[model samples]
Target chain A: MEQILANGLYLGAQYALIALGLTLIFSLMNVLNFAHGQMYVFGGFVTYTVVAQLGLPFIVGLIASAVVLAVMGALIEKFLFRPVIRKSKRDESTMLLAAGIAFFLDAVILLLFGEKQRGVPKVVNGVFNWDMRLIMPYDRILIAALAVALIVGFILFMQYSRTGRAMRALAQDRVAAQLMGVDVDRYSMIGFALGAMLAGLVGGLLVTITGINLGMGGPTSVKAFLMIMIGGAGVISGAIAGGFILGMMESVGLTLLAAYGDVTYLVIFVTLMIFLAIRPQGLMGKPWG
Target chain B: MTDQTQTTPIVKGSAMSMNRVLGVGAFLLGVFVLVPVIINLTGRWDFYYTLTSVALLSVAAAGVWLTFYIGRINIGQGAYALTGGYVSAVLMTQYGVSFWLTLPLAGIFCALVSVLIGLPILRLRGVYFAMVTLVLTEVARLTALALPITNGAKGITSIPLPGELSILGLTIIPDFATLENPKLAFYLMAALLMVLTYLVLWRIVNSRLGHLCRSLQQNEELSASIGVNTAMLRVLSYAISSFFGGLAGAIFVAISQSIYPSSFVVQDSVNFMLYCFLGGLGYVFGPMLGTLLLYFGWDLLSVAKEYQLLIYSGALIALMLVLPNGILSLLDKKGGNK
Candidate 1:
């Protein structure tokens, strides 16, 4: 149980950061942003290029990934997302459109990076001894701290900052927010950029622990999807809670089910299905109707 | 969605007839027939599996079409195909069921298994549904790998091809009187695809069921208010899709004569989606076109396996960006809008 708890928290940190981005986009855009996973992959690639290829400092790579993805998010908003929003294409169509972009982006990355699994060098390597019997990676400890800090910081911004309030306003009622002079497009761009940056941050943290690879995005995207479903979309707390729940479920699943390493994914999806059937609004989601 | 705009009636009675359908079907049948003959005639038996691969891959593509027509994407088709292939291979090799008997049984098993997966998964909406399907396929893969029955990672092989059948001690194997050889398995596959396509789609698309499904696609709220049980219809769509997906897998096993879990990976599912997307979604004929072109292109690209993924991804990106709808959408530009 201790091992499961330890593993779950470490895994959960990654989930929370990625899910935060997914939920933010869902709340404001009404789309799942399927390419968010690809964005995560892009984050890994950026970090790898800076730290590994360019021989830059680890901090420089981490910061550069967030900044670069922020720009990519803006571009996505301006080009890919703008048309979907403007047309008010059915929400389903928008999701498909985003998926198409993700598919294309993943392909491009595969072409550019190849499919080999490459691990980013661990920035900090130490084991924190809790009990005399158990130890955990210091990298994991850092990830957990960063995730919590980011979540708190995001909540504070949403509650207090003028731009954050504008984002909230746009999410709640786009037309009314527009009437109140909250530039909807600008707010959406802000939401998207923030989402990308957070996803990039997770990607950076992930590579430091696991590795960088093009195929990572596909499963990671599904995990984010499951997290949003469980926690309910558009709510920051929901994203965090959902992410941890998913991570815990996966970790427990791995320990209990010896033969299936990918059991985490299957269990998460099945859980999502049950949750959606019982409460489509999610654990914390408000009913759109 | 763009194709939804191209509903202008063209040659309504003449072009859409069962007779025309048969004619087009026969022409397609003839092409499959001619290919192998040309191969045999040219004395290139080494290339036979290539043609077989195309025909078999079409079955998976057709499976994609079933859900796609209803405006849902089932990324798990490869899982279903793998399920059928594995089941058929196992039943044949271990239990010694004749290859022919095992084939249909595989299809039946896949349909039943899909129901189990679909029951929980069908609840997800749109992108969520796609996500869940993706997850389920991966689950299917991992489960297959973990199972002792599958021999774990090693996989099962040497599935014996059933010998010629006899009814009451009389040979059921008719002599190859002319062009219809026993290798006419390709023709059998083509025929099954056409029949399944017609029965599952042409019939549904022309019926009240089609109206309900399309209505759900167009406006879920309005459809529900108007007495459509949207959830039930969606489940029905998935079930039907699974049926064909299983059938495709069965046919694939029959043609290939062996099965492995790796044959139906997540990447293959994505490729199947690429086939459907490239051909055009929501059209009965779309997957057919997409399968033929994409696989044909894949075969051509095999020489450069290292660069194939790059080119494949690049092409997919280019296609989706240039034609969000699909290649068939270009049919409109050709003034065949009718």
Candidate 2:
């Protein structure tokens, strides 16, 4: 039980970061950025290339990943999403554009990073073992700590910073924010960049422990979607809660249903579908928000 | 929402005008008669496989398009397709049922399954519905992997070809095994199904049900206030949409003689939506044209080798930017106003 708790906490920290980025994008643009996972994978590859290939420091690699992804996110918003959203009558049309960008990023990732699974060398070299009941690597602990720190920082930024406040206002009501003199286009880009940076930060942090691969992009996006759905779409606090809940469920499910093999995910997915059916608004989100 | 001014004009006019009949007849003649003759002259038998695939894919895309008609961004059509394939495969391989019998059975099963799934999620807002449907393909894949009857990861394989159809000892259709060229046989079967699927789709879009569905698309609340059964309409369209997906999948399995969990993945589902968007969501035949263009475009890009996907995606993005209303929108006199 202690081990499960520890594992869940670790997973929750990382999962929350991913969900945060996705929910952030959804709230800001009202576009479910399908390429968010590809961005995460791209971040992982950036970190891998920096720390492992170029022999850069782990901190440098992480920062580089965030910076690169922020730029990419900003450019995509300005060029692809912004114009498409402005011109297209159907709001759902962005989904096609998002899917296209996902494919583009995926192809780019494959060509640049290749299909091999890659991991950076561990920054710390110790295993934290407690009474033979719980075991985790020190790198995992460090990554989890960093993830938590980033989440807190993000929350604080959203609460206190000018740009963050403008973004929050934009998410709350786009027209109202515009009427309030918020530069909708500029802030939308910034929010997208910040969201993508969160994905990158989480990806870079977790690469040392879990490794990264080309195929992980789609599954990662789906997992993030599950987390957000569990909590509530576009609800920041809901994303955090959903992440921890999903992490706990996964940890417990995987451990208990080990003998059953792959049934854990199937059960989780079906449960999510049922849960959405029961409460379309989710745990924290307003109905149709 | 402000951009909703550019409404897709409710398809109006004589249902069967002389010009429309002639145009459709000529198109059918080209598909059924000219294409096979051209393939024979060119001696490119592989074109049959490619065209058959396009036909099958467009059938599934038609279902996706129907959901779009009702204002839902469906990304789960692949789940129905996969389920349909498995249903047909399992019945044919394990129960010793004829493939001919499994086709409609597969579609009916998917329609039933979709009603159950759509009942709840269809009430959610568009994006919520879209997100929920997005996970469904993966869920279907996992279910396929976990279920014992599906043969797990190995999948059901080497299923026999579709047998003859007969009534009262009078043969209506000969067995596929007895055909001289199964490729040609599959192509014709797929084309026939495609034609039938579109006919039904056209009929639905022109019918009163389709009009009510369009109202749901425009404003569900207003429609509901005006005495439309919004929930029933949504679920009904979704069921019909999924039925088409199932039909496509059943035929696909028959052609391949196999069914695998990985046969229809999330990418294929996304591509189904892409086909709708590419062709023009406003038109009934949009998905068909979109599937043909995208499929042939991808085949043409095979020479690009490693850069094929990059080019394809780039082109897709550029095209979406240029023609947000889709390729058919280009034909509109006012350009997207229709």
Candidate 3:
């Protein structure tokens, strides 16, 4: 039971970190940004390049990736998404559009990078043993810690900061916020960039746990989608809840179906379908409005 | 300007063009029929099977085009194909059912599965629906892989050749068996089936149901408010599409004589959809063009697998960037102007 709890926390933190970016983008632009997973892949690859090839400090690689991807996100919104967005009838079309773009990018990346599992040197390697009966990696512990800190920081930023307030206002009502003197476009641009930046952060952290490759985007993006659906769209708190739920479920599933490694994905999808049917508005239904 | 505004002239011109189109279509059909004969004359009759493969893929792609007609991009259509293949293979391998009965049964079974899955998914909108279907396909695939009944990813093999049947005293036997040549059988069955499929689709497009599908794509709420029974129509379209997919799968298994999980992956779904989109989603001939173009490209670019992906991806991005409506749209516009 303790092992399950620990496993869930470690997995949950990773999921929550990834889902935060998805929720932010979904709320602000009402777009699912299917390519958000590609951004995570970008994060992993760039970090690998810096740490593995360039021999830079892992921390420096993380920071640099965040800056670079944030800019990329802003540019994607300005160019690809801006004009065609109105052509999209619903959030679904926007997601499809983004996914098409991601498919192109992923293929290009795979061509350049090749389909090989690559990883960065672990940050604070080694495992922590509790009474010799429980052993957990220190890196996962660091991930959980960092995830908690980021969640706290995200909450404070949304609650207290002026820019964050503008972001919230834009997410709640784009036209109303514009009428109220908020620069809706600027908020969206910033939100997209910041969301990407967070994804890059998670990407760097993820490489420490699991290897990175071009194929990671599809599975990662699906998990993030499931998280957003379960937690509710447009609510940061809901993202946290949704991520943890998915994370714990996945961890438990992996444990139970250890013989069938891929079975976890099926469990996650089945659980998500059931949960969404029951609470279409999501876990934090009131706050989603 | 006066001539342009005249409906009689435009209508007459369009009617004339329609006649030309039918003539051209018939010419193309004739060429398609003669492909095997021409290959046989060249002493490379084995190429006939490859052509049959293309025909089967085209039929499956055409089936998927039905769902696309309703403005829903279902990534789970491959699930139906996989299911159909597995059902036919299992029945043939385990229960020793005749291939003739198993063939049509596969289509019916797949249609039923499509309705079952489409029920929950139909309620989902946009990307959520697409993503959910993708996930569902994966789950279905994984379940198939795990089940011992499927040989657990080793895949079902040695599926019997479709048996002869006597319906209304026709005593139909597969052509290849009588000719003692596989290529002859392939060309006769696949080419004929494809021609029939195309005709069926053409009829559908000209029918009222096709107009309703287009209306559903344009605006769902407005169609519903107009008493279109939009949901039922969408479900019906989905079921019909799955039937085609299943039929294609059954034929696919019959030709290949094996069914495996690897043959039906998420990438297969993505590839078919890509073919549809690249061919031009709105055009009836889009899938055929897409299948021919994409398969030819796939053959040409087989050397550099990684670069092929990059180029394919680059081309897709460029296509969307340059021709949002797809390659067919350019021809369509040119045809319209002419």
Candidate 4:
């Protein structure tokens, strides 16, 4: 039971970061980036390379991953995404373009890193004993804490920062934002970069546990999308609620169901279908204007 | 969405008359019919498998194109294909059903299943539908793995080829077991199926229902407001798409001689969509052209060994950016739009 709780929260936190990034972009630009998970993997590998291979400090690696990935994300937005957007074919090729980019990233990673996963050393090695029975790794607790902190920091930024206000305005009304003299192009780049940066931060932090699996992109992307959907797309609080809910559900399902663990995805898939059928706008996502 | 504004002239049959189209189709049919013979004569019979696979894949892609026509992207056709493969396999192996009978039965079964699944999900537009379908193949694979009837992950194996075409042991058509190059027969069979699949699509596109479908693509709200049953149309298109997908899967099982949980993965589902896009989603024959080029393109890239996937990805991204309408759009300036 304790293991389930810990794992669930840990998974939820990781998913929270990824889902937040996805929702961030969706709210700002309405682009459902299919390649976000690939960037996550790429970011994790960047941290692994910087810290484990180059013998750099973990903090330095995290910062470096964030910066490098933010740059890559911006470049991708400018070249791949912006062109498709400029053509006014946003919905058509967004999925395919992101998927193509994801595939490209997968191939690049496969060629450069090979198929084997490279494990990263724990960020901190300690144990937290609780209630004389439940015990958890301090590394896990740290990872989870860092995830929470980043998320809280992000919420505050969105609440207080000028860019955050601009993004929220854009999300609410694009034409209005443009009329208000907000630079949609520049903010889109920032939104995308910020989204990628969050994915990178989570990827870098979770390297202690996830290590680095090249094939993680597909499943990761799906789960993140699921979180956003469940939380209601276009809402920050919705993303958080959805991510934690999914995390707990997955944990409880794995623990209680045991032999029926795989059924969890089937359940998720069916639930999403039902939810979309009955509530197309989602709980928090107002129909896009 | 880009194609939504542009006219679908080719599929509407605005440019080519029936005679020219049929004449071109007949010439292509003759070429497919002769491919196996040429391979046999030269003794390079292995290409028949590649040809057959491409043909079957085109059938699946055509199904995806139908959904694309209705303004919905289907990334879960693999589920129907995989289900179709299993249905035919089970019917043939356990129930002693005729291989010929299972093919259309599989299509019907998949159509029914798709209708059941689509009725609810079709209400959601755009990426939501695509997202739901994207996970469907995975869900299907998992279901196949968990179900006792599917025989777990080991999967059903040794599926017999379509029973011999014979009368009182006097063979009019040779069985796969006895043929020197059974792939030739498979190629011809697949080609015939492809021809029939497109013929049905052709008939549909020329019909009133096809015009309604095109209208939905161009403007869903306008059509819906005009009393067009957009929801029912979307479901119908999806059902037909899955029917084709299932048919292709059934044929694939006959050729592979087995069905597994991993028989058709999510990647194959994505590839089906890509084929439609790469072919010119606007054209009915686009997937046929796209599938041929991509199937061969993959083989040609095998020489690169490890870098094959990298090059493939590059090609896909570049292809989308440079020729978003698909390579077939390059055939004419007025937008292949078929």
Best by lDDT: 2
Worst 10 residues of 4 chain A by lDDT: A85-94
Residue-wise C-alpha lDDT for candidate 2, range A159-228, written one tens digit per residue: 9999889999999999999999999999999999999999898889989889999999998988898888
- In model 2, what are the clashing residue pairs, if there are any? none
* True-vs-predicted CA distance for residue A9, candidate 2, Å: 0.9
For model 1, what is the error of residue A201's alpha carbon versus the real structure, in angstroms, after optimal superposition? 1.5
Rank order (by lDDT, best first):
2, 4, 3, 1
lDDT string, candidate 3, B95-183, tens digits: 99887788789989998987887776676665556666667667768778878898877898887677777788797774344657766
CA lDDT, every model vs. true structure? 0.73, 0.91, 0.76, 0.84
Model 4 misplacement above 4 A: A1-3, A88-90, B1-19, B26-30, B41-43, B166-173, B332-338
What's the candidate order when arranged by decreasing DockQ?
2, 4, 3, 1
Interface RMSD of 1: 4.2
Query: Candidate 1 clashing pairs?
Result: none
Off by over 4 Å in 2: B1-16, B334-338
**Best by TM-score, which number?**
2
List model 3's recovered fraction of native interface contacts, to 2 decimals: 0.28
Worst lDDT window (10 residues) for model 3 chain B? Answer: B1-10
For candidate 1, the lDDT comes to 0.73
TM-score of each: 0.85, 0.97, 0.87, 0.93
Candidate achieving higher TM-score, 2 or 3? 2
The interface RMSD values of the models, given in order, are 4.2, 1.1, 3.4, 2.2
